[model samples]
Target: MVSSVNNPAIAMAEKPPSLEKEPMADVEVGIAVTDEKDDRPGEGFGEVSDLKRGLKQRHIQMIALAGTIGTGLFLSSGKAIARGGPVGTVIAYTVVGLLVSTIVFAIAELSALVPLSGGIIRPAEYFFDPALGFAQGWNTTYATAMLLPSEMVACAVIIRYWTEQVNNAVWITILGFLLLVSNMFFVGVYGELEFICAILKILLVVGSVIMGIVVDLGGGPKGHRLGFQYWKNPGPFVQYLGISGSWGQFLGFWRVMGSAVYSFSNVENISVAAAETENPRRNIPKAAKRVFVRVLLFYITSMFVVSLVVASNDPGLSKSAGDASASPFVLAASSSGIHVVPSIINAVVLTSAWSAGNSAMLGGSRVLYGLAREGHAPKIFTRTSRFGIPYVAVLSIGLFMVLGYMTLEDSASTVFDWFQDLVSAATYVHWIIIAIVYLRFYYGCKKQNISRDELPWKSPFQPYATWVALVSFTILLLTGGYTVFLHGEWDAETFVSNYFNIPLIFALYFGYKVFRKTKMVSLEEMPIRRFIEIYQDNPEPPEEPKKGWRKLNILW
Candidate 1:
């Protein structure tokens, strides 16, 4: 495989290198790093204009944290519990965590092998079939796009917790627009804002976890020792959903496990964020290795702390576990028998949701830009605003945010439920693809006889771990359609969740293929290196933070 941006737009006085040629007779076409010169007008078989490397290590770290813990975890964990029972949910999350770590390790290895603007997608073309790589990349892009709206919807829901006046739908719409404006400006500013937001999210997660641990350890929410009776009496397993204390008689515990999976989905986004980091070789692997441990610490540990103090069925908890304001952290604090921690938690949820949403938009736009650079999509996506932001793609993805807000026009929670179902189902498709792509790439590497040592970071267990993640992810995607199987209230969950993904993805993939005459590229014929080299925009490590904001009183 060769570097893709061997020819940058700037300082190329020498004649351009030849690109791959196409055949008129053959129905199948492939993209490879050859020199035949098809020289198609819109689809230039030339080097992409090399982009700047402005992102620092701190940005990558914060994005790694913020990206992994979305509102899905904060809000939907209750739903997962409702579906999978405590025991089932526990096993599912742990399993998902294990699988996610493996796929990301595979990804980290690939990123180290070929770090490009295209990131993981770059390996697909080199290692697997080019068509597979393109399809996987595009689908992942849509999945990322879905996140922006979901996060904004989360933002609106958080805001509604504070007021009864404004319609929640209206608030979502407003917030989406504001977020769009922020992202459309410049990448650096967006990075800076996101950095601050990430810090706030970390503080909230750390503070709330510490407080909950203290409260549960006999310090008392109200000077009364809760003493972990929930664990003993509820018996760790719940035994029964409504059977008072038995763990077996549950209605929807599996459903709860489903929610837990979503919480962990953002964990993989860290690899995507690594693509844009300044010193990827140094940072992407570091971030990927730490992300898994950090997720275990932040998510499992914090939830463990919450379960100690608050019962799964705590009434003080928001009736809508899907709402950020109703997060276990805040509700448990409200029951804290303590002071203003509940209110503070609610405030934290608001910022956390915002940061998650921003990260989604940021990733989606970057992916879209990468698409254009590969000559697979239109050129407009390549255009960046003065702020070095992909203004057009950002606007396009942010438009989805309105989908979440439009539901707010109704007082009934029906719209929110439907939106959640759609996003949840769509999200599964994305995860499934991520796993499949990585696993396929692993096998493809074998077919080509690539060595593990050549990979920057190696996945511990080769085929077994990748298959485990793929199977488990596929299970979640299939089970996501359970609502469709119900005899009554089919309309409640809506057809969107059950049937939308296949068509949406096919339309985008095949439609572009026919329009651009793109076809399957052979593994050897794939453009492995020419386009990938530009991804190594920065091959060095970034500097550490110079300022200490916590020390100042009026710093901001």
Candidate 2:
């Protein structure tokens, strides 16, 4: 049933003639898209679908980078350091970082092949069950929608460090408008804004680390040589729930996993823009790889530096003050008598929150659009403007941005905490589903005789790595609210915040299953071969040439 395209490169629905012994050094992929009828069924976008290919390679790289560096790093790390202490916090983030890298690699490999608009959402349907795809698509959309409010609220809180005179709603309204404008204009605008925001975040992280070093070396104005003093005095571990000895220390490390996971929540967002990026087959894998390395470096190095500069027992580390002064970087600088650093850090966090909110809009709206296209949501949600913006979807999610004004009636810190717990557990569920999706794809590849070498990006030790991350994330999800279960330590809000998402995901999964009468896809029936064929049909443009010392750019 394959087309008789003599070029071989443009053949659709054919099995690869043979697995290459070694990876193809540079396969010439055409820009030619497949004929509309031959594209996957039940996935409704066609050749004329107006979602513009406006995101360039740098856009995606910055999108992925901006996705990871958010309020979680700038603000929440202080709380995590307080709970887990310096050493425990560092170890916890490192473990979660590695696990995130695994997930990123797995997604990168699949995204290189599929390169669809919805990213992992379509893969779930293709590889497993359509019902799961429906559930995942909506869950991701909801999580992302909720994140918009979360980041907006974070911005409001950050602004308080400078002036509490302005109403929280005013700040939320302004930031929300900014997010809406950035997304509604063009995908390229979103990319450009994120690129600039990501650079700012990068500067903040590097500057903070350098400043931490200077303070530690007694080179700063305070003349305090901190070195490992905090680690030694606080002794590197905080006993959780008053549990003594090794068990308590273990719990301390385990506790920070939630924060670590939250910080990396949207790293997978790189692939969500696949449909809008040119040459997704090449660019997505590249972006995915860079996201992992850059996010890891920013997160791990910042955590290490924070550990050195701020004592875990510092009251400031545990302070729930709704401002950037509570951020560990600001605290570290303040301790070394650097008065101006707090406002500087505050400005960076404000942009970080804005950037995070922008990503939420892009990710959430696209997921909703994908759901509509797949017939999981209302068809009207799929409507796009002449410029390719999903106007309806964007507006639909923008309505939820008003949730940021919740901080007006409640304490900003309290509202932020509530959103944090919800997003943290939801993110764990997302990761678990990603692991399952990858495993199913891996098995289908094996069953269909698709060699790893034929993939756009090959991840080593595949099935095993996926399994480990799957189990670990599942464990984390179930235990995310362990403190709530501790004797005499229970709070209804905490318990609900941490564990509610577990049942909600289950409800969505089963609710969709029953509603759709869906069944799991058999390995033989999965369309791995069709996707590979589709990938072969479209050749990517040659990579843009790098000029001068720009050729030395490794972060991108």
| Candidate 2 per-residue C-alpha lDDT over 1-556 given as tens digits, one digit per residue, 9 for 90 to 100 | 2122321222222334234322221111111243233333211124224688788788887777667787889888998998898999999999898888888888888877877667688677667776777888888887887788877887887888788798888989999998889888779899888889988998888899999889888988969788899899978998876799989988888989988888888888888877787777777777767755775679888899899999888899777775787799888888788999988888988898888888889889988887776667897987888888988999999999887775553576766666778888988888888899899888888898888777767876788878999999999998988888888988899888888877777898889877756667766666677666545644455677999999998656
TM-score of each: 0.79, 0.91
Residues 245-324, model 1: lDDT tens digits: 33343325545545665666556665554444565665667667776687687777766666666665565443663344
Measured with C-alpha atoms, the lDDT of residue 64 in candidate 1 is: 66
User: Native-vs-model 2 lDDT?
Assistant: 0.78
lDDT of each: 0.58, 0.78
Q: Lowest-lDDT window of 10 residues in candidate 1?
A: 6-15
Can you list the residue pairs that collide in candidate 2?
Answer: 29-539, 30-539
